[model samples]
Target chain A: MKKTKIILGIGALAIASFFMVAADHIDAPAVASGTADITDFYAFQAEDPNNVVFVANVQGLLSPSATASAAFDENVLIEFNIDTTGDNVEDLVLQAIPRDGRMYFFGPTIPGSVGVDSAIETNATQTSVAISAYGEAATATTNAGMKFFAGPRDDPFFMDFAQYGEIIAGNATGFNSPGVDTFKGTNVMSIVVEVPKTMVGGSGTINTWVEAKTKQ
Target chain B: MNNIKTILGAILISAFAFNCSSDDDSNNNEGSMSIEPDFSGTYTQQDQMGRPAVNTVFVSAASKNTFNVTTPDAQGAAFQPMFQANLEGLSPAFANPGDMNALMQTSADFTGLLATDVLNLSLDGETTFFNPATGALLTGRNLTDDVITIELLLIFGGEDFTENSQLSNDNVDANDKPFSASFPYLASAW
Candidate 1:
């Protein structure tokens, strides 16, 4: 048990180290090369208020041509952490990984540990969903009263980089009401799971966050 | 009569000004504060292309000015969410080919998991080319072996931005950041 704790602590430390890499906002000549680095995370209610969607995007500012050939990281585990209570701890988790051409999704199940260390609860009512190989190909899975989708598609984040630069240079003070998006006409990999409102929590406000777990 | 009228008007104006000022002072000021992302915690992931992904994960941070992880979560469980590819469009995010290689986050209308579509991928897109084995740039994606544009999202959870404060934002991500002409990989932390 003590060894398990140590492993979890080390994993948390590593994650803590990388967590601060900022979204795509370049200023220095040296770091400017990595703007394609990941920029943000979004989670919200779907069109059908009954469900919640979690979206994670990476590799910002690629030329459409460059974005075309990008590949995915096989070692990373995209895990959605759900905190039914206000404690900011994950009560249930859903993880997604790709094997071959198909993307696989697991859970809505309770995680063994809520913070640093996590083990797949294989004993739980596990569900597997295949990703739509093509973009926007609609394939769904109903698990724990939720629907899941794993696949690739277009990039959504938008920004007017020129305008942002102008603002940063002090030429302009503030951004337009809704600033321009530089990420328009791009693409990203997407994994989606729609869970019933009840599954999330008792309808009261609950804070939910997403995490990417790796094998230590 | 004109002098009297002018004097009376001045007094009336002063009274009106005072009344307005008082009213303004009593009015409550309300506004929402953006939850600053904490720059300290870890939010990193590997690409999908590499057969053996980065043995070590990389932290993807937000910019110092825009985002930061102010507080770290006390309880564990939630790992920093990572994208598989860049998704196009808003909400009901449509996937593309960016997920396999990197996590792309920016403040825009559209964002999603990190992978782009096979058809949309480009020669520069695959991880096998740069990350080799892992960085294989896709071929036959378009008329030319071009680099596909990708979008990433960086979330620092809750951050603090007070009027008077200094911060060390290592994770620096932005649209203006550079890219390699040939093959390359990028990482950051704020």
Candidate 2:
């Protein structure tokens, strides 16, 4: 196993005062520049009220030119952890990995083991979708009442980072009305899954998080 | 004009050929072990996220790697003090004695919840990231939802949402692109 040591950034700035504010875009230096960098995680009730959707966006701040070449690293796995029992430990996990040009998905099944390390649940129910290219129509796949998609998408996070920076530097006390959207034209490589509520197995509530792991 | 047509024809042929080959590969591997990808081995986590901005705004620069690798169940005990101290130090809304957020949580209580770092989604509710009008809080996050603004409100907007007028909202209210109304709703990339 190869471990990448990250050199922490400048220590002069008061860390607490500088809020990056755009979810995890300006993240810690370790995974900040790589495909493993997770920029945002969003879970929401689907259009069909009985279903829920989970989205994990990585490789943020991709420009139009960069997005065309951006690809989901085959060595990296994106996992969505669902803690149905409320203990904050994942009771179930949905893992997605890319092979060739398609994204393969596995599990809403019980994870064999959990935490910072993960083993792909090969035996779990699996499905896949061809990754959509930059200028093509989006593609999606469905199996066992679950739908999945993996591709580049316009970043949905809206933040006035410039104004926030001003506040941090004491140059401004408040954001101006209708502040500038700093992430206006950026993009992210997004992975989305929509699963039935019954499939998630929570007692009407669940604690979920997303993680990107590199194969060792 | 003939040269342009020849170029277009060549491009179309290559695209069609590429598509057919990939489709054949997928068909061949449909349910067989011959082409089944190897997924065995340990994958070490390098990055993680749950609730937007929780780890970003609270964990210090040096502690980020530690915070990312820490399990959510263990996060509170390990990082609550750091979160609480930062919240109290940075936000004026939490500075005053007995100050409480819109959730009616004190600095310590709020930080405690924030420290856990996992998004608490209600599987059977209005799924929103703090909708003031309907009083929905952290059920889930929607694409069009003004999350940063909402987060600012929770952090600096007092219990009744009338305090710290300047600090309470980011003023950027919506996504640059409108999301689709159906499955895989995120808009196509720019």
Candidate 3:
């Protein structure tokens, strides 16, 4: 398998950015329920206070039985896009892909190109962690102040999609308080990375996004 | 485009799987048959989303492909009209019989805000969805933020923000499991 590098960027600018939560559990037809489907992307301040954690969850809505046999596809690269200048253009990316039962990661490095296209950054810092198997202890690897984990995790996004559907169809007026979660029992393949804020961009506010780019 | 690619990839993967299974049986050897995995060439973007429910709420079923591949910068120009139309359909503000949506600002301004689908990270203050009660608005997402509720308010809630109290929140407020306090903090799978 060829090495796939992902670029992730974190900015520590003194400025503030608008907060938004974007998730799409609806897998479009082309990559519906396949390994490349990105159901949620989360970037938040870590508990350490000095670090930010980036979590990208794919292959959404898997059942307990289905997750036991599910695995990360080697050909698909999950890239975290970081835009430091507020241009919505990625300045750095962290790429993650699996190979030989291990998840290999590359970058937090600048890319040669950007936007809907990516190039492999072979010379960037590389780290590999054993892919945590289902029903086993959680495994994490840390190197140079960066921590990585790849495995199945509970789907964290809570949406009363059925109720929202009703509102959309004009059948209902509003959502019920303390609504039911349609994704209560499901799971998703998760890739988690925690890194120091200084390592990404240090002192500028950055816009971050995640992408599941399949190798051509 | 991604559907076609996935179908082709599936055929190739199944064929390769068959080859590997047959080779293992014939050789009676583990790792004897060389099954080189091909991860070469360029992988195209099949589906993309920056914010929750933007594609789901704004884009129609037929326009998903175009919406997915279009970059965030180009999105406002391409899909803002469609989003405006969809907004009119879903928002009760627009559906008030003879009265127009109270929040019906110019299509350009409203749609431009929704078009570029990137998550903003506040490097400084609280990272949250919308905290109108606290007066902090749209900073970035925390794991527990009621994002759908915020999106609904923005779409349906008018200028004074008191328009639709009933239709705004979905009520699913928290995650199924507690988030961890350490690295790789997502909860474990069931």
Candidate 4:
């Protein structure tokens, strides 16, 4: 028991260190440069207005030509954390994982457990959709009022990162009129989930975030 | 929206014909997958984020591991000072010569505000990164929020929000492609 506990602790720490190395776009340590890296997280009111959508984009900085064969890693799970009480603790979690050309989704329901660790919530309300292949028509699946999609999409984040770097380095004062889009023509593998507001604890204020976890 | 959905529906219908074997039995009956995912052990967090550029801008490379592992609840206490120092260092407009931005929050308070690093959303109101119409801040993010620009302005713009105009906007105004008008609204991959 003691040995097992120590091994688990070391494994958790190792995963934590690996997690720190991935944030937005290129510049991540080489080990995390692939699918494990998350580029952005966006949560907004869906067009239905009664539903909310959460998008967690990963593996950013892929050129158009390279995006053709890019795919989601089967081992990683992307989880969206929702905190309804403002305590910064997640009350509910919605997770997505890809397998055999489909992205499986589980839960906008209260997590049976929470924290740095997570279980697949295989028992929670679940859904799945075909993983939209690059250059193919997109595919989305709707189940039990929740919608799911996982696939590659044009990288939506636009930035003049080069100029911003210059400004931070004290070489430039401001950006030019039409700032160069450093991410132009790049793509990211995006996982999007839209759920009814009521399903996510409904009608007040909430704090949200995203994390990528690998299956142990 | 209708056109994309129609296209998607057709593709799904055709794809399902060829790949129906992949569907897990869980759809008709929950927890009944013949092959269950390996969820037995704890999967530790590798990375977390609530807002754009928070970790990349505030955390020095040396502190990336420490910063990434800490939870939002503990982030403020653990890294607020580091954020403040970095903010002041990167933006001279926020340091000795220029006053802090319009919020007038002290360095500690400012960093404290950002340290938690989770996006705040109000369910009852319009979801947006910031509502310029009402002057509200950080409610939720939109596809075209120009978040980096907003972050720069808040950190270096000072009391008038005009202290460092040059450093305020990044010049990239919108995504290269227009977002979809329906479910799963991200633009198509190039």
Candidate 5:
């Protein structure tokens, strides 16, 4: 009963990233409903069309023993906001930050400027990797092109809360189409990253969002 | 400063003496067990009571691990935004929207096994969040607007990719199972 750390943005101007569910767990009065707090965000175009991919999820019903020592809140700074020509503002910028466990990527390059206030191009170049250790498998693979993973999986989200609670108790008739999946047997706590679509845009239509910046 | 105010007054009485009253249960019984809140809906591969299980898969991956999962294009993504948040004072039957939430939530999630099918995986270790009213064990420390779900297991493609692990390998496949996983997608927490 002492919460006070929410700062989600949209048209207002932190823009991009405000929950794109693949995983969602909110209620009990919308417990910090930061854009519904996404559990999945993926962008495509990379078999070498240049390269692009981004995943963002924040503490959404985590388990597997609290995602086995959950890490990556080093003040939180996982911004992968890019909006090209759609007038969403952000032209091209890719940022990822995680201290010790190693996950420090930044930009596709050009960023002396790009909507709002994002100054950390660090010379329009930066990359640091090493955050895949929790059930191990990727002991050093995708670097430069980018790669990083934080623990705990499963919870890819599936629902049917008792017939969606009998269609909000109207008795029924609305859901049941693909219903009944009361979180199978839940779990959450994943923060993965894989990029290479020539960075994030060198293809067709574009408009992306993923943010969780907390360092005041 | 007076020995730092006597070690911050003994760490605030040892953080309220870390509670130890033999405890009883009483989340107030708001929703009694809470199950309906609204998060939109869509999930195949049944079996919780309604039957039908397996052959409901949706996989998406560009995973290399450095973080860049394309964005949208999952298939137009018209609206994948599920919403509903209300737990009234947090616990004790909660009472409000159609009332009946005493809070005892648990949505564990995690076990994207691989490393050799985690040696015929089979481990369902449990730790699915806790709060039976005021027992409190919420993840992310003191969980508030709590509601979370995620289960996306995409073992391997292109020949199980021989060997290339990095989930902080304890030798990979650290079994804590619910078994039956065949990649693609599975994000839970409705």
Candidate 6:
């Protein structure tokens, strides 16, 4: 048991070092460019005022050439957690997973269990969409008042990392009038789900987060 | 809203019927065959995010993994002090006692909110990330939202949007590509 504990301590130290190199658009060195690396999460009011869209972008900084071969790992499940009670615990979860070139979705329903571990809400309302290819027209599907799409898209989070480094290093005072975008030409695997307001119950407000969980 | 519900109800019924028939159809276009997904095992959390750069900026390197796994409800109490210390060290806007940002939040209050690391989205109002015009703060995030700039402004812009002029904004004002106008609104991959 002491040996096991030491091994775990070493592992934790290694991860801590990895975090020094990680940034918003990237992650720890262990899973830096892996499919489970979540880059960004966005929840916005849809064009239809009654609907809200949640997007989770992963595998950041893919080049145009690299994007063609980039694919969602079948083993990773992207879960969107919604908390309506202002308690920060997830009251409802929407899960998406890839299988056989298509993306399958479950929930916006109450989860069987919550927190770091998850079981796919297989019994919830299910929907599927053909995962779009790199250079093809986007594919989307709607079912049970929710729309789903999954595939590659431009990394929308903009940053001037080089300049940021300069500022952090005390070499620069502030940002330039028109700083260069460090993530201008990169790509990310994105999963988007738009659900009606009626489905996600809250008093017009909710706390939401996204997590990438790999099958254990 | 009622009309939309009526239309959606009709669509839902049709979709249910179509799904029932497609379940038996062998030639469904989605894939080779329709099968219930086997979600029998546990999935361990690997990475998590809510607000765009909160985790990247606030959580210390040694605590990144710990913060990622810690539930949001528990995060503020666990990390707020660390976040406040970091903010006071990094940003001159919070350099002194009782210094506040444009939001009128002291370093402690600001860091307290940032420590939780979850997006607070408004379901009924305009969704945006700190819109200057309408004062819509954290209702949600839009694809085209200049989130980094807003975050920078809050961190360094100081009271009345005039402190630390050099550190106020990133100057990368918009997304590299235009977002789509329809559902699944992200721009095409480059």
Q: Which candidate has the highest TM-score of all?
A: 2
Residues B1-190, candidate 6: write the lDDT tens digits.
9999999999999989867876877666676546555667899888888787887788776787788788899999999999999999999899999899999999999998889989989987889988889988999989988888888889998988888878888888888999987988999999
A1-216 per-residue lDDT for model 2 (tens digits)? 123222233432334224444688857778875899999999999989889999999988888999999999999999999998889999999999999889999989999998998999999999989999998989999999999999999999998887888887799989998789888898999999999999887448899999999999
Query: Clashes per prediction?
Result: 168, 0, 23, 3, 98, 1
Provide the DockQ value for model 6. 0.50
A1-216 per-residue lDDT for model 5 (tens digits): 123234332342222112112222331122233322334443432233344334455555454555556666555555656654554445666666666666666665655654333445655556666665545543333557565554445654444444434433456544443334554444554455556554555444545555444443
Q: Is candidate 3 or candidate 6 better by TM-score?
A: 6
Give the TM-score (vs. native) of candidate 6: 0.86
For all candidates listed, what's the TM-score of chain B alone?
0.15, 0.80, 0.70, 0.78, 0.14, 0.81
TM-score of each: 0.45, 0.87, 0.80, 0.84, 0.25, 0.86
Off by over 4 Å in 6: A1-23, B1-36
Would you give me the overall lDDT of model 1?
0.39
Q: Please write out the lDDT profile of model 4 over residues B1-190, one tens digit for every residue.
A: 9999999999999888645543644443443333444445556677777888888888877776566567788888889889989888877667874356777866667788998989887777688877667886777888878887777778877776787787777777788899887978999999
Tens digits of per-residue lDDT for model 4 on A128-196? 899998998889999999888899999989888867666656687688888988777988999999899
The candidate maximizing lDDT is 2
Top-DockQ candidate index = 2
lDDT tens per residue, model 5, B27-88: 42553432222212221110000001100111212121111121222211221110011112
**What is candidate 6's CAPRI-style docking category based on DockQ?**
medium
Docking quality level of the chain pair in candidate 2: medium
List candidate 2 stretches off by more than 4 Å.
A1-21, B1-34
Residue B26 lDDT, candidate 6, scale 0-100: 67
RMSD value for candidate 4: 11.3
Indicate the residue-level lDDT of A79 in model 5: 61
Ranking by DockQ: 2, 6, 4, 3, 5, 1
lDDT tens string, model 2, B1-190?
9999999999999988866665667556454323546678999999999988887778888999889889999999999999999998888889888999878999999999899999888987799887768988888888888888787877888887788878878888888999998989999999
Q: What is the lDDT of residue B127 in candidate 4?
A: 81
**Proportion of the native interface contacts kept in model 4:** 0.72
